[model samples]
Target: MDVIVIETPQLGDRSYLVHDGAVALVIDPQRDTDRVDAAAREAGVVITHVAETHLHNDYVTGGYDLARAHGAKYLVNAADPVKFDREPVTDGQVIQIGNFSVTVVATPGHTHTHLSYIASDGTTEAVFSGGSLLFGSVGRTDLVAASDTVGLTHDQYASARRLVHEAEHDAELFPTHGFGSFCSSGPATGAGSSTMGEQLTANHALTDADEEHFVRDLIANLTAYPSYYAHMAPANAQGPGPANLQVPESLDAAELTRRLADGEWVVDLRNRVAFSSNHLQGAVSFEYGNGSNFTTYLGWVLPWSDKLTLVGEHADVEDAIRDLSRIGIDSPDAAIGTEPHAVAPDAPVASYPRVGWEGLLEGRAADDVLLDTRRTDEYAASHLLGAVNVPLHEILSRTDEIPAGKVWVHCGSGYRAGVAASLLQRTGRDVVHVDANFDEAATAGVSMAELTV
Candidate 1:
């Protein structure tokens, strides 16, 4: 049996296709089943089964649709509160597909009903640890609820321990999260490939013998996740239809301007530099140029019910729609063109100055408010002296707290600052995007401090 990995880097998750040359089983597919179907075809295997480890809190799953399309048996946990029909599998139940034998293991924590599948074909074994035991960290326990966090963290610890004891130490590890997904409890080891043995040595879930210590550190370090996460599980439980990848109706400059005026999320998909140079007066900067984070940030900050319009090069606009669809934001309207003014002729033009830490040092007056848009933990670690900290994720809710001044916002790598600056700029604040890497700011002798708490 050969295991093919289908990585959704945009969402920092991976789905697996295990096949015995003729038949295959797909695990935890994203909303776009086309990619899974293409993989099966490319491998010359018929999809005999599709399984979901849990009702995902991240991307909407394509498992149900993919199963229906291929006439494959869909496997979901019997305990999941899902409305869709599937071959409900329970812990310890074994299923056969072509040359592979899959044994389901109850590993709850990512969610209460989560399951990890161990697939073996004679000599080789592979564990499909969907958001459970990731590379060096486990999936975050907070997605369920604030009240459930403690219980779930304990469950997560136990689950990781169970996997290490049950699965072979040499079993190849393939987790669906921890590669930059917010679902991760913390930073992963960043290794490309790992085995259960490696996780046993390096994963905190395994190395920390004291479960209480593990839980405390994990909970305290838990940072703010995307606001859009609230809508995903419900959508998955109801079983969303196939993703709508079809391009939305193209709007002329006048219609686009009207949409912007009406307070729709008209996102600009140029680089932050280009967007800082000039943009549609009301358009939000969400640059789609290599925007692996396009869906994450855009989905996080935009009001969930707001109609979205993408403005960029034709290809970039199309790609942004595809990324948005994975997160269940479907069929957003499009305005294709490179230049903001060119795309929407009647739209007012806007520009903001972007600079490095040195430029900030030279020009910043005593009255200028330096805004640190990194996370709270990041601010605690090290930040510009006297900079106001409103983490990028909390920027929407805490906007009123930031003092009125010339806001010079900066983040670890300037991405979050770019997004924050645009939101502030849209609110009629005098803003400057600090487009420099924070690592450089240190060597450049910028004043920095760490929060005492």
Candidate 2:
């Protein structure tokens, strides 16, 4: 038996194709099924089955298309009875293809209809545990309000422990998610596969721990999930289905600008840090896989007629388009202009009002309001002599709280200050983002201290 794992970057998703002789089975395919088809054909294998571990909330699923295109049988759980066309996959139910037999195990928790499939060829052993047990963390239990999460998590933990206890000690575990994938929090920089024994020994969540500690730890590390996942479950059940992700042709800048001006959504496919620093004024920054989380957000925020224009870094056009296509977006047009010239060649360095010891006397001479946007704990650690706190996220929520007449906003390295400055500017408040070069001001005997919000 041969097993191949395809890792979709940005989203940290993995798809697998396992075959024996000339028959193959695909597991948790992404939106684009051409690649899977190509691989199967190259290996002289006919794809006979497509299995979805569960209705996914991350990227779009390709089960329907893969099955239809290859005339393969689609397998899914009867418990969920998702509206998609699939031969129901139930607990202990086994399917044979070539020499391999896969047995279904109902593992619920992350979502109500999750599954874990154990596959063996009577020689090598493995389990395509969809979202159940990732390398370090279990799938997020909060994907939905399924039963009592606390109880569900407990049940999940117990079920996972069963996998650990039952699967062959040397069975290679192949999951549909990797490190960067939201499905797990394991370091995204490591190897993709691990033996079940390794997870049993090293996985923090699976270690010997009481149920309460495990549940608490599970909830603590989860970041705010992508804002768009709320709609994926229903869409997957209804089978909006997948599309062929063809490579997109590049567009010139003028075409890009035209599209945007014509109300097309411009999705900036760049890293978060790069995107945060500089980008086209109205372009929405969503790095590939991560962008899908915000796709629904973009759909609602922007009109449907808005065509998507891609802005990629380092000439990563194809990579950007491929990532976008995974979320049901297909064949977007590229910008129809030259590379963007330096807008602010010598963009003015951000600046703001400064204070000094002489300035302190000057402040005493003329009362000046010192503003800070660090966390409250940071503020308690240290603060400017007379600065007031206004945490950044809440700034817009409580605009009335920021003093009207005069306020100087400063954060660690001026990044937060710039964000705050933009927010304040929108609200018609006079504010300047401070440069991080406060040391120069302090060197000139300026009185500087930390401030928290």
Candidate 3:
């Protein structure tokens, strides 16, 4: 069997093309199906089967289109059947295509109707375990509400535990999401593939944690599933239809800065904590990880804009750039109808409106609420006095906890404060950010206490 894993880093998603003889199977495909079609053509193989482990919450799934285009049978979990044309895959069932065979095992922890496809090339076995289990953690159970929620029932979790036991100790496991992906809470790193044996022993959530504990930890750590999933999932399940989907253009740094100065949004796609610390003063933050599904999220949540800039982790810029391309969001040379804004050659970090103590005091005097959006531990160690604690990650769901008024957002530095400002601004709240810490204000002889909100 020839197995190729297609990594869609934008959505932190993975799809596989497995073939034997002249038959091929594509599992959990993302929105873009051009590559799969091309691969099949190059190999002179017919795509006979298109499989989806489950209806995803994090990104759109492309199983339906692959099936429709090639006259292949669409495969999904037998339990949660889609209305569209698809063949139901049952637990302990095996799909045979010439010499290739894949076993469908019901692994219901991540979602009630989820399944894990175990591919066997006559001898060796590899399991595409979807969101059931990941490298260091498991899929979150709280993404669904009542009827669709999975892994909460005792029977459901036990079934997951059983799936782990059923797989061979040496079977290669491929998960839907790992580190750095919005699916897991731990800092996304070193979260490569691992064997069932490795995960059973080294997986933090699996080892030294009970099934209930695992479920609780998964729920507790999940930041927030994308709000776009409510619609994107159905669209994907039915198939995204075509590749002609249009996405907006992205602005370069200078153009983005100019738009920000002109009262346009500069949505940063970095992590929550990093976004809070230092960002452009008037920027808004969505913090969608480097993935294609974020495209739909951006479309669903944000109003159509002529200009936008994507700020990502320095290391993630390329992947982030690629993901944005999947949805047709092109990077433009400049913002339309505006000149690029350039910072001075010798400008200090404190020179930005969101960076230093001087701006912090002025922002406070503007009757803006001083918000310290950092982790509780980070807030405890040291922070600007009189700044209320409101971590950026919790700002969305905990919006009511924040006092209503003009807001001044800040963090240990200025990144997270930018995120807070962006989120707050998106919700129609006026906000400003300081350039630096309180010490910078004190050094500049600014009275932070006197500038009361």
TM-scores of all candidate predictions against the true structure: 0.97, 0.71, 0.68
- Between candidates 2 and 3, name the one with more favorable TM-score: 2
Per-residue lDDT of candidate 1, residues 63-180 (tens digit): 8888888889999999888888889899999998888899999999999999999999978899999989999999999999899999999999999999988889999998988777
Runs with alpha carbons beyond 4 Å of true place in candidate 3: 38-45, 146-156, 185-190, 220-222, 237-239, 246-352, 356-368, 372-386, 389-408, 411-416, 422-453
> How would you encode candidate 3's per-residue C-alpha lDDT over 268-296 as one tens digit per residue?
56554454455455555555553324554
User: If the candidates were sorted by their TM-score against the true structure, best first, what order would they fall in?
Assistant: 1, 2, 3
What's the lDDT of the predicted structure labeled candidate 2?
Answer: 0.66
Q: Whole-model Cα lDDT per candidate?
A: 0.89, 0.66, 0.62
Candidate 2 lands at a TM-score of: 0.71
Worst 10 residues of 2 by lDDT: 343-352
Collision count for each candidate, in order: 0, 11, 25
TM match of model 1 to true structure: 0.97
lDDT of 1 at 208: 95
